[model samples]
Target: MNRCRNWRAAAAIAVAVSSWTGASALSQHKHVSDEELLNLLKDAAPASVFAGATVLNMAPDGTMKVVREGNNGWTCMDPSGTDPMCADAGGMEWGKAYMTKGPAPQRLGFIYMLRGDNGASNTDPYATGETPDNNWIKTGSHVMIVGAEAKSMIQSYPRSPKADPTKPYVMWAGTPYEHLMLPVK
Candidate 1:
């Protein structure tokens, strides 16, 4: 059943990807639709946040001071604010260090990047997350899990995958909140 759902979802993305035919055309639009937001949630925090989530929170540009609660005990903080992300309770703790202008968290946490991704810097914790960075390729469909060991998962793979939106790879390096970029593919 899970496999069937995965296939169906992938099919939908394939269709969506196909529809956004060219670079110029896709760029003209900000990709703001309920479907697009759901896709972002899936990529950013899939294991915790599911497709049937009752509410989809949008925290664009730091409008929400604190993480907003949702029906399933999930915390989402993005409509497009500071990298558009989501997290579970544990992940929220793990990501606190990087969430604001603070130091790295003492322990691990996680987050999701399903919505608008401008890709992220491997070395710069203060990475502006501005799009068009040749380095941090957009995470097509991926999740972030905070753990020092997570770096091993990142080291095992090539960085190229993260640079290409078509592929998947762990993001964040040389920083305190680095994590595993498990691909939904």
Candidate 2:
């Protein structure tokens, strides 16, 4: 049953991924001071995660530049002015796959968004705004579980397009990029 749903969801997934702006392709439209960028760290992840996480900033044309080097394997950045997050190595791999429209990696990927997200279409990975049919949801402080492992965990939570943003649910459910969204706030 899930296989059938996954197959049907592929076309939509393809459409969504084409418009998604990933970490590497994050747009920096306006002039932002380094201090502001660095300050975003506080809300991006827990103090422990950000303390040793590498900091990255994207240029106006979507070029990624490293701002701070850290020993831990995690990376922290604000993909857009509104969305700040921290991702471990596995999460980074999952993101790369999402950007390239490839298969999810086998390992589990974790991400922290303590500050909260602006909003996104629950059914479409890259729908920038709300449409008549697209389910747009803005989740407050949450952590994401991604990659192939996340697919297996979907059956344990609600997969509704109209997911409750404050609960544990599957975002982009039925798609290759589907993942677990556990709200923390």
lDDT of 1 by residue, 1-185 (tens): 24334333222222222111122222233434455555555555565465432323332221222212245545543333224455554454454444443554545555565544554554444444444553544555556667564565567654542444445555565566556666555
| Full-model lDDT for every candidate | 0.45, 0.71
- Model 2 clash count equals 0
**Which of the numbered candidates is closest to the native, going by highest lDDT?**
2
What's model 1's overall lDDT?
Answer: 0.45
TM for every model, in the order presented, reads 0.53, 0.83
Residue 157 in model 1: shift from native, Å? 3.7
> What global local distance difference test value does model 2 have?
0.71
Kindly report which residue stretches of model 1 are placed more than 4 angstroms away from their true locations once superposed: 1-61, 65-71, 79-84, 100-103, 129-134, 149-155, 159-168
**Candidate 2: segments with Cα more than 4 A from true spot:** 1-31
